[model samples]
Target: MTGLRYVYAVCRPFDAPLQAQLTGVADDPPRLLPHGDLVAVVSHVPEADFSEEALRAHLENLDWLTATARAHQQVVDALTVVTTPLPLRLATVFRDDSGVRQMLEEREAAFRRTLDRLNGRVEWGVKVFVETERTEQAGSEPAQPAPKPASGRDYLRQRRRQSRTNEDLWSRAEEFASGLHTALAGRADDARLHAPQNPRLSGAAGRNVLNAAYLVSRDTSEEFVEMVDRTKDDAPGIRVELTGPWAAYSFAGDETGRGEADEERHGESGGESGEEKTGEES
Candidate 1:
């Protein structure tokens, strides 16, 4: 394959071979480029599409970005199964083999440090959605119409009551999320709380109150999963989600000099944000 080189991840050498038909971005099969003790996982892509000027235009298109991120993620996922991988930002491209080697050389120390920290660990994503009152009331009961407000004063009073109720629900949700994060953090080696996810992007119902990633050792992952399960039903109107055993993307740190647009790839699920498929898929 000939063109610009798209680098997917950096990791230590491993004996395990990638899946025979595993294809990366631009439909090119990935190859390992070893630099010192670190290996850069790279594949070729058309310069017309991957070059700096071309990428700036393509990234504006969501369809193109999503496809690229998914393909990039597939390579990272494969690496994760065999060994811990330090995932680079989406759309990381280089001019050629020498450029790729220079990157590995430049970032060697940082890569080794992050890889060592994430060696046997994986990332687990936890999200909590609070059910809205309208959602809860669906198909339950039809309430009698309230008498028309006697005056503007009464109308204002009614509005205040509704506002307070909404505030109370949100407060409760925040409190629950705080407690849950505390409990989960107790079990995880490290934890990060990202901004609440947008419902439009997540496609999950209700209000997203918690978007967090926890780093846990492989041996205790099962116990960590159970810990999340036990809290799923703890709050009446709160919903909990768990995704992972994925490569520690959230904990990998930004050694790649990733742009702001690239950072958007990690919305709620660390690396798989804005994706519809479950973590187990691909």
Candidate 2:
């Protein structure tokens, strides 16, 4: 009750309850802080850890950042299950409940609009990866290495073939991903494209071609999932992934309410693709 408020999301009143033992960032239980008809889902965290200065330092520590992001995500995920929440960016903190209330009052109109737009809808994430070399392989066997070049001319010829093959595979991957995105977008209320994740960071195999989030209605979720399933085997060496029924994280934005300083500080948190601010800090 005494520490800085780590806000996870904003929502309209709902009868559904959060888990009895739900622990949010800083291992504190989240409580609803209502202002007017809106509610701010928040948890108290130590100022020593959540202060702007402390956060700037902690953001540099991957282990700390990961833990925090995971905790923040837990609260947002929980909210998704009970109501349509307009998630705040990761690590959003305010000095006190008063500050949180001020934010709510300032953003009330935008919040209401976004929440209405997102009600009865959820977010779906899809990613496509292409392992170019895998396309050249036959079955599960490793590709046989080319015989040692008999001459410089032979080596050059082999190089050309390899180059052409690589080009063709990449081209096909691009085409397939583009086509798939178009199809999914058609079925979604809204769509957002994100930068391909770094392999080192995501630890995902193959080269990423598409990273997208779609806003989908709950009623048609099964059909949307089926559409994604049907594309799993559509391309030989491409990998497709789907994740969702998530809170409409991608579409939650209140540009009019976001001050320049806040925008500079939080940038694009809590919206679209659920990207974390783990890379660089402003």
Candidate 3:
């Protein structure tokens, strides 16, 4: 098949081996694209599948997008075992090695700065959710109002009670989410808050009150985790889950150098011409 280079990440040159049995798009094993003192983790893909034209179509296809994201993440995860990888966006393709080298040349200084900040660091994702459903053993006592109110007075009373209850629930949720994030961020090198996820979108059983990412050095990972655990008892009805030790996806800056996920191609010859990236979708 014709060659199209798919880049997973950029890192300082290392002597260790990449994770064995790892493959990226098209089931092709990723290889290194080293320029100067830096190395790029890359793999080959079919020209038609990864080209600019094809990407526009493939990105809109859910099945194709899912497969590509999984493959891309697999490669980045493997690299983390040996080095701190600054992850690129999914479907970041170039014509060949020359393009990859050009990216390194243009972004070399910025890459070094980010690497220095992230050298021994890995990203941790913390999601705080509030349980909306009562436990199974609550004995099924009226999920909602059992019967219509007998009078307007009763209806007004019920409505007043509900409004107060809702106000309390949301007030507590806001405080709980804020406190949890503050505690975690205290122990991390840096932290960022992402948009709160919807229940249907996250497929989580409860409302996602807090969605944040923390950049913690590898040596302090356990300390950060332990801190997260301690915060749980302080906030009872809230469910706190910790994920990762992952590559620094959320912390990595995107195009325009603003550190966000811009969904367009953004590379050129100028010093500011940069790569665009976002945190993991999987």
Candidate 4:
């Protein structure tokens, strides 16, 4: 029989029991696959139901995905409460237990190192959205401009002017992002700048200038949040949003063995580029 695959996470040995209590759908038990000191929280899926079309359907439905993800996260958080756990990428899967075992064997050292670095720490996300500048309305009567420039030189000058304006805006935004990152870095175990996303969807009244996540020790979570709050209060024209005290989802690299190398890589370079929420889609 072809068994279904479910990818969960790798955590310390002591975390397994608490994770089991909070995991899976309804009363269904989560499969705790252990390897040495590391444990993978998984569950069996039906092969026929996990085909390409089915997988696509599953991913496309936000409600289903969100519920499943929340359930999965509950377990990861439970584990985190007891021990440091590395969260795998969303939707990581394997054909069976053997596949998971092989992956653990292949990347054993890297996983160990990642765990070592992340031990006793958790991840938090903070996003800053810059309010869009309100455009000034021209007076009621259409303002007549000077005679149209007949020379190409004038047109080139106008183009250059616009280009400079665009460059200036981006430069200022980058500067702001950098400063915010620096401010928070002092209070965090690690800080990463994430790529910005669309303003409309990210619940921002204006443009999103900074999207970032920080990994901080559990004991320091409150202090880190306070620092972020202070930065938001001090900065004008920007609104910051914070989520997490969550499992180190953003910091968790590729614990799954399905060649998710690029997608699951973490640390300073692995986060979202801007307004995009890392690991939100999958």
lDDT of 2 by residue, 1-282 (tens): 688888888999989999889999899999999999999999988989977777767766756766787787788789888888888877778888888899899889988888889888998888888887686773667778899999999999999998888778778889999999999999999998877756764567888888888999988989999999999987778889888777765577632122221222222232222233321122
Using TM-score, give the best candidate's number: 2
Tell me the tens digit of each residue's lDDT in model 3 across 151-189.
Answer: 999889887876675556657878988988888888899
Q: What number of clashing residue pairs does each candidate have, in the order they appear?
A: 0, 1, 0, 11
- Which wins on lDDT, candidate 3 or candidate 4? 3
The candidate 4 region of ten consecutive residues with least summed lDDT is 273-282
| TM-score winner, 1 or 2 | 2
Residue 157 C-alpha lDDT in model 4: 85
Please list the residue runs of candidate 2 whose C-alpha ends up more than 4 Å from where it truly belongs after superposition.
138-145, 254-282
201: Cα error in model 2, Å: 3.0
49 in model 1: Cα distance from truth in Å?
A: 0.7
Q: Candidate 4, 53: how far from true, in Å?
A: 5.7
Residue 108's lDDT within candidate 3 is 91
Compose the digit string of candidate 1's lDDT tens values, residues 39-68. 999998898887666776776676787788
TM-score against truth, every candidate: 0.84, 0.86, 0.83, 0.68
Clashing pairs in 1: none
Off by over 4 Å in 4: 1-3, 19-21, 25-27, 60-64, 133-176, 256-282
Task: Point out the worst 10-residue segment of candidate 2 by lDDT.
Answer: 256-265
Quote the RMSD, in angstroms, for model 3.
6.7
lDDT of 4 at 129: 62
